[model samples]
Structures are given as C-alpha cells and as structure tokens.
Target: MTAILITGGARGIGRATAILAGARGWSVAINYVGNEAAAQETLEAVRAAGGQALALRGDVSVELDVLALFDAVQAAFGGLDGVVVNAGIVAPSMPLAEMELDRLRRMFEVNVLGAYLCARQAARVLSRDRGGRGGSIVLVSSAAARLGSPFEFVDYAGSKAALDTLAIGLSKELAGGGVRVNAVRPGLIETELHASGGEPRRAQRLGAGTPMRRPGRPEEVAEAIVWLLSEAASYTTGAILDVAGGR
Candidate 1:
C-alpha cells in the first residue's frame, strides 16, 4: 500500500487530502502543531474511510519537529511513498508598509522555511540513491503567488512564490533520483484559513469576481494535490498546477 505524510493534516486542504488518501486505502500520517482534538478527529475519519492512519504533533517551523515528524512516519510505515507539504499560515490584510517585522519573519519562517525543511527531508528519504523507493512531494502553494495578493497579503504571496521556485528547482534536482516534485496553487478556497486572516468571508466575498463565480471547495484542491502525489502523474514533474477557478 502507498504510504503518505501530510503536514498540517488536521484541517483545511490538508484534512481533505488525508481523507481522500484514506478512501484510496493508503496509509496516512497526519501532522499537526496543536489542536490534537481536530487531528484525532481527522485520524478517525481517515480510518473510517479505510486507510491506516497516524496522528503526529509537530510545528513545521521548527527543525526538530520536522525531523521528528519524518522519523515517526518512517518508523510507523516502514517507508514513505508521498508527502504533501501543506502546513502554512496567513495574517490579517495589510499593506506591505504596514506589516510589522515580526509578522514578516513569522510569515517567511512558517511558509518558506518550513516548506524548505520538509522538501529537504523528503529528498533525503525518497531519493533512489538513499536506498529507498522513489516517491512524490506536492507543495501546496497559493494563487497568491502569481496574483501578488496586492494590498492584502504580499508577504504571504512572496512566501508562496518561494515554494513555486522550490518546486521547479527541486523537481529537476531530484528527477534523475526518481522523486517527482510538483505544486498546487489554490485560490479563494472556503476554509478556516480566511478567518485567521481576519476575514471570515473573504473567499465568498471575492469569489464572485473569479471566472468560476464561486470560491473553491477544499476537496476540489485536494483532488489536484492527491493526483500529483499518485502514479497517474508519474511522468509529470516540475509542474505548477493552478487549481484556482480561473482567478
């Protein structure tokens, strides 16, 4: 059976992907920083969907936590087949000038640094030269990367742009090693992420402006992400897929 690890798997797109992986009968390792309750709930849902599940607690921004997370997955599953680097955060709307130093640091730390750490470990474990089977690494970036998020979240946008570059560069670096690297950019998704950004209805509010006339569902993005992690995308590498509804 395919074994996968999804960071920030307790909620949002991560949770959706974990449940979907479960339905496909894959062994899933769900990592969360806090909210064990939600993580356990997701864990139960995955098992209910017929997948072997493990709930791990870790803050992606911390190197020790990232290492422990990968180690735990290796210990439990014996090996890993795929990884979804989906843990990220967003702050309230603000112009670049109004953004505080601490906010910028936190944004880059979690979104960029955390992603790089995970990608690095993924390469180490999934490379054919490392004596392990090759696998996939799907980074969950944002449409904001290209859109620039303007007056709203330029910092977040910049951070996501880093992931896009990482996906492109790392894909080539690992292509010969049998590891496929890709990314999914989701736009205006309906999730608790907006509330944390201090705009509870941001998606619903701005979604009407998109070509699709509505915000995307978490499951919609999950489909694209899971596909990137599966053999169906075996020949697809270094691809940055946009899951936005033509926004």
Candidate 2:
C-alpha cells in the first residue's frame, strides 16, 4: 500500500488532504502540533471513509520532531510514497519597518525553516526508483507570494516566496533522484490563515479582491494537492498549481 504523510493535518487544508487521500486508498499519517482532539477527529473521519490513517504530534519547525514524525510513519507503513509539507504560520500584519523582529522570526521559523526541514528529511527517505520509480512532494504556498500584499503583510508573502524557490530548486535537484517536487499556491482559501493578518476582516477583503468573489474552501485546495501527489501527475514536477480561483 502507498503511504503518505501530511503535516499540519489537524484541520483545514491538511485535514481535507488527509481525508481525500484516505478515500483514494492511500495510507495516511497525519502530523499535528498540539491538537490531539482535532487530529483524532481527522483520523476518525478518514477511517470512516473506508481508508486507513494515523495521527502523530510534532512541531514541524523542530528537526527532531520532524525526524520522529517521519520515523513513526516509516515504522507504521514501511515507507512513505508521498509527502505534503503544509505546516506553517503567519504573524500579525505589519510592514517591514513596523513589524517586530521577533514576530518575523517566528513566522520564518515555521514557514521557511519548517518547510526546509521537512523537505530535506523527506528527500533523504524518498528517492528515485532507478527502474522507473519515485514519489511526490507537494508544498503549500500562497498567491500572496506574487501579489506581495504590501498594505497587509509582506513578511508572510516573503516567506512563501522563499518556499517557491525551495520547491523549484529541489525539483531540479531531485529530478534525477526520481522524486518530483511541486507546490500549490492558493489565492484566498477560507482557512484561518487570514486571521493572523491582525484583522478578522482581512479574509473578507481578500474575497472581494478576487475575481471569484468568494473565499476558497479547504477541500478545493485538497483536490489540487491529491491530484499532484497521485499518478495523474506522473509527468509533472517543479510546477506550481494555482488554486487561487482567478486571482
């Protein structure tokens, strides 16, 4: 059986991905930071769909935690067939000049270093199948990376832009190794990501800015992620699938 690992799987997009992947017959290992209840809920939801799933707790920014999470998955499922590096954080909105240095550091810790650590470790375990074999790595990014969100939060946008480069570079480096690295850049997903912008009204403003005139559901982004991680994207790599709904 193909096994997959999804970080931040307690709720929102991560939970959606875990459930969908389970429905598609993949063994799922969900890694959440501190929400046992939500993680267990996801585990139950996936299992109820006639799929197998396990929940593990870990802070993705810590190397040891990430290593242990993968170790557990390796022990439970043998080896991972795919991974989604989706765990991250967004600090309260502030311009570079006004943003607190410590706040920016915290965001970078989770958004940039966390992804780097996860991908680095996952790459070590998942390599090319010389005889036509390999797995997939899907990184969750944001459309704000391109738009810059100057008036709102540039720090978060900058961090995601760094992730974009990480996906692109790793894609090239891992191509020969048979592992495909790609990213999903969502526009304005209804996920609580916007609440961190220091304004509960930010999500509404974003929705108004989008052509779709509504925020995207977590399930919508999960659909794109499941596709990229599946055999359907056999020939795809180093690509960013935009789930922004006409941003």
Candidate 3:
C-alpha cells in the first residue's frame, strides 16, 4: 500500500490532507508538534474512514524530531510514497522594522529549515526504479511569498519565498532520480495561523482582497496537495499549483 506522511497534521490544511489521503487508501502518519488531543481526534477520523493511521508528535524545525518522525513512519509502513511538508510557523504579525529578530528566525526555522530537512529525508528513502516511478514531495507555501503582505507579515512571506526556490531546485535535482518535487501556494486560508497572530478576522480581510471574495477552505488546499501526489499528476513536477483563487 502507498504510505504518506503529513507534518502539522493535527489541524487545518494538514489535518484535512491527512484525512483525504487516508480516504484515498494511503496508510498515513500524522505528525503534530503539540496538541495531542487534536492529533488523536484526527487519528480517529482517519480510522473512522477505514484507513490505517498513526499519530506522532514532533517539532518539524528540529532535526532530531524530523528524523524520528520519518523513522516511525518507515517502521509502521515499510516505506514512504510521498510526504507533505505542511508544517510551518508564523510569528506575530507586524511591520519588518518592528518584528523581533527572534520571531523572524523562528519562522525561518520551521518554514524554511524544516522543509529542507524533510526533503532531504524523503530523497534518501525514495527509490528510482524507472524513468517515471518515484516518491513525491509537496511543500506548502503561501501566496504571500509573491503578494508580499508588507505591513502584516514580511518574515512569513520571505520564508515561503525560500521554500518556493527550494521546491524548484529540488525538483530539478530529483527529476533524474524519478522523484517529483512541487509546491502548493495557498492565498488566504482560514487556518490557525491567523488565530495565533491575534486576528481571527484576518481571513475575512484577506478574502475581501482576493478576487474570489471568500477565503479558501482548508480542504480545498488539502485536495490540491493530494492531487499533486497522485498518479494523475505523473508528468507534473517543479510545478507550483496556486490555490490562491486568482489572488
């Protein structure tokens, strides 16, 4: 059976992806930094849907945690077919000058470093049996990387921009190995990141600014991620599927 690992799978887009992947017959490993209860809830949802699922706790920013999480998934599933690098952190929203250096660094630690670490691990585990058979890596980026929410969260945007380049470069590097690397850039999703920034209504404002006039749902983003990992997108790699609703 195909196995998939999704980081930050306890809530929001990550959680939705885990559920969707499970429904599609992929044995899943849901990794969460904290909030074991929520992770368990997600685990139950996957189980209820008749998919084999496991919940693991780890901080994606830390190398040890990333390694352990992958090892655990490997142990449970025998091998990995794809990975969704959806774990990310957004520091308090503020202007560039006013944002604390530590906060900015933390965002990079998770958003940038974490993604590279996961990609490196996936590279090691995936195989190259033929010209078109290999694992897939999907990084969760933000449209803010291009839109540049200057006054609100420049640090977050910069981190996501780095991820975009990471996806492109790795896509080229791994193409010969038969592995596919790509990204999904979500525009304005109603997720916990906004709540942590002290503005639950931020999604509303962002939706207003978007041409769609409504924020995208977490499931919408999750569906895009699952599609990129599926066989239907076999010829797709180094591609960034923008789920921005034309933002």
Task: Go through the candidates in order and give the clash count of each.
Answer: 0, 1, 0
Worst 10 residues of 3 by lDDT: 124-133
Model 2 Cα displacement at 113 (Å)? 0.6
- Distance from true location, Cα of 145 in model 3, Å: 0.6
Better of 1 and 2 by TM-score: 1
TM-score of each: 0.99, 0.95, 0.96
lDDT of 2 by residue, 1-247 (tens): 7799999988889999999998987899999988899999999999987678999999988999999998999899978889999998887776788988788888899999999999998788888643323699999999989999885778889989988998899999888888999999988777766776667666567788788888788999999999999989988999988899798
Query: Scored by CA lDDT, what does every candidate get?
Result: 0.96, 0.88, 0.88
Judged by lDDT against the true structure, how good is candidate 1? 0.96
Model 2 RMSD vs true structure: 1.9
Q: Which candidate has the top score in TM-score?
A: 1
What candidate 2 gets wrong by more than 4 Å, as runs, is 129-133
Minimal lDDT window, size 10, model 1: 123-132
